[model samples]
Target: MDSVTVEGRAAAELLARKTSLAQTATDALYADMPELTTRYGAVGRERCLEDIRYTIDHLIPAIDLTQPSMFTAYVGWLDDLLRARNVSTREVIRSLELIEQAVRNELAPDEANVVASFLRAGLDSLGAVRREG
Candidate 1:
């Protein structure tokens, strides 16, 4: 396969894995606190899903199209998006835990690190961007 194809596939896999993680996290959160779905309202749930979808769409493509910096930028965008929504810290932690669990289940250690680093860097970059913007 061509370099672009290879990169795209890798990025796709990364995104799929991330989506799985997010879904797992969301499921667990909903299961634990059934009220959250109601408290947040349908619009809120839709917004949250939209944010996740946006991350998978825009952020993953950036990773495939550019280098690590671009990937970081995407993550930064996600961080800003999440923060703007005022997602709770507990929710963030749950998401991270779900990511960790999914990574452990589906990826090798090194691969998992790559995914985690991308997420962490993106979050950090987003924080900086939010502060400046």
Candidate 2:
């Protein structure tokens, strides 16, 4: 296969895996906090999906291949959002670990951190608190 085809396949696989993970996480979150579903309903799901798409489409492309420090900005953004949400740090860590595993397995060397950072940003942005941290 051509290089582009290979990369495309890898990207597609990563997206699929991440989508599955998001679905599973959402299900678990709802199971644990049924009130969240009642309170936010469809809007919450829509926002969550939008966040995922934004990360996959936009933030992933912003990574600097030669400089890992660029990823720190994304990480810090995620940290701030998570802190705002009061999302259990353990849950955030678990989700991040899953995304990192997928990216490490599927992405090219220069792109792995980008995907990881995007996942962090997406999760944080989706359900973060309205108030500042």
Candidate 3:
């Protein structure tokens, strides 16, 4: 099979494992930011998982279709939503960075690279917005 087909398959495989991946990533996130549990309790923990799951859900499509804009747009929208809820930009940046790290750690090199590219795109989008404000 061609490279594109192989990459698409990999992306599909990642999507199929989204829940576990999100859970693993959320575990890493909480380990890194324990205050989330102390500050927000069970509700906060669940929100973190849901947010990471939402990101993964959008991310797989972006990777499969080879469209960074798809993921970046979602990041932008998420940033807006979080900002409206009074979540700081630094927290958002840290969360995405940690998710990228956690997800990358779980994949093979090739798949990890694909995931990194999309995560970087999302981070870059957030960075540009941050620079503006």
Local distance difference test, each candidate? 0.58, 0.50, 0.81
Error of 1 at 20 (Å): 3.7
Best candidate, lDDT-wise?
3
| Top model number, TM-score | 3
Write candidate 1's Cα lDDT for 47-132 as tens digits: 65555555555546654664567766555545556667776534544454455556556765655565565556655665565568
Error of 1 at 29 (Å): 4.6
Worst 10 residues of 2 by lDDT: 59-68
Please report how far candidate 3 places residue 80 from its true position, in Å: 0.6
Who is ahead in lDDT, 1 or 3?
A: 3
> What TM-score would every model get versus the actual structure?
0.57, 0.42, 0.89
Candidate 1 has its poorest 10 consecutive residues by lDDT at 1-10
Any runs in candidate 3 off by more than 4 Å, and if so which? 1-6
- The ten-residue window of minimal lDDT in model 3 covers 1-10
TM-score of 2: 0.42
Could you report the Cα RMSD, in angstroms, for every candidate shown? 4.5, 7.0, 2.1
Ranking by lDDT: 3, 1, 2
The sequence of per-residue lDDT tens digits that candidate 2 reaches over residues 21-69 is 4555455555656665676688875654444444344333243232333
Please write out the lDDT profile of model 3 over residues 41-80, one tens digit for every residue. 8988899889989988888878888889999999999999
